[model samples]
Target: MDKNNNAVELRNVEMHFNMNKEKLYSLKEYFIKFMKRELRFERFIALQDISFDIKKGDVFGILGLNGSGKSTTLKLISGILSPTKGQIKTYGTIAPLIELGAGFDMDLTARENIYLNGSVLGYSKRYMDERFDDIVEFSEMQDFLDTPMKNYSSGMVARVGFAIATMTTPDILIVDEILSVGDFHFQQKCEERINKMIDGGTTVIIVSHSIDQIERLCKNCVWLENGKIKMIGDAKEVCDAYKKS
Candidate 1:
């Protein structure tokens, strides 16, 4: 891929939200409080002055601690939340694995949910049919195909979700801490699958808490602290610095 070919770009992007300072019992109570000038809110800035460019086929990592806006940044890139200011531009189709069960119906069997979830992902019936077996094999849920997902374990659900979400080689794959899915052995399987996607030239943006995982899988990275960029550079250097902090 061309070095100048950008897969994702953000310029001075910022996110803001007004958090309620008090909770009311109902809409009627909220209206009475608002009328009486009792409503209070605090401005929360989730991201500020964020700017970065992810080149085509680049594996980028975002590292941060709890409440550091790491997941918020991924949500912005995945279009789950719009930026409050600045610009964001992305090239090619995006596959976001931010929430594994977003499209799942808990009452539905894994078999039914596979096709339903595929449709939610914008795949046609024929497309899903062709890849159905591959999905089952990847998830290793052959025995539970007919079982309701409501009865499945968290790891089991995550595996199926991950398998379906990554079935195709997307142009841009936005993964948010999904590597923690399943057991240690299954985590390795997930990493191997992601590695395969990287080999296929997918532009992956990963947000992970594991410093070693970030260094191993990413070429470049950014560290965010208090919703601001603390460092941005080679993955190893960034990870090393973040680990020290």
Candidate 2:
């Protein structure tokens, strides 16, 4: 942990998208010489006036309904997507498990894809080398290690992806609803590993629609509604409010 307690900060961040609306004209209408503007555009706001700070060793939970900009907020923090407005500053090395199969090659074997994905996540060949056996064991992928990833089941793919993404320790860990992919046993393993990371002073940000997970795992919480901050406070309180609403 650094001298500053806050590991991540979002200052009035906002993101918006331009949606185009097209007008339909029938052949009869066109023949009658009745025409209008072909295209109209509307600005859709995905995140509005979102501000929060996450401290090192904090298990921060982001809870919201679908399309509430939970994933967008995680992406903005991880540098996967830039915010359209406001500012964000984060310290320390961040490991993000945002999307499964985001970087894996379908044609490559599981073993080969692991190395490729590791490199994409900023791990060197030697680093992967040191952790290779442990990753395979944790993923329970030993049987299909040499098989092409496309041949594996969806669960298998997620296991391998999760194992590779989390093999190396990080100063900050960001998870965007990835625990829903794996089976119950694997989810338990992931939770145990995440708890270990938290114990070791790694800042964790969990974005999930599962209010139970948020309440169980997070010490602090934030709720987002229609791209705006709804609540920020104790995990139990925010979850109770979300459930009631």
* Predicted model with the maximum lDDT: 1
**What is the C-alpha lDDT profile of model 1 across 173-211, one tens digit per residue?**
988888887899888898998999999999999998888
lDDT by residue for model 2 over 95-168, one digit each (tens)? Answer: 99998768999899999998999999988999899999998999998888899888989999999888887887
Superposed on all Cα atoms, model 1 deviates from the true structure by an RMSD in Å of 1.8
TM-score of each: 0.95, 0.91
Residue 189 shift from truth in candidate 1, angstroms: 1.7
Error of 2 at 159 (Å): 0.5
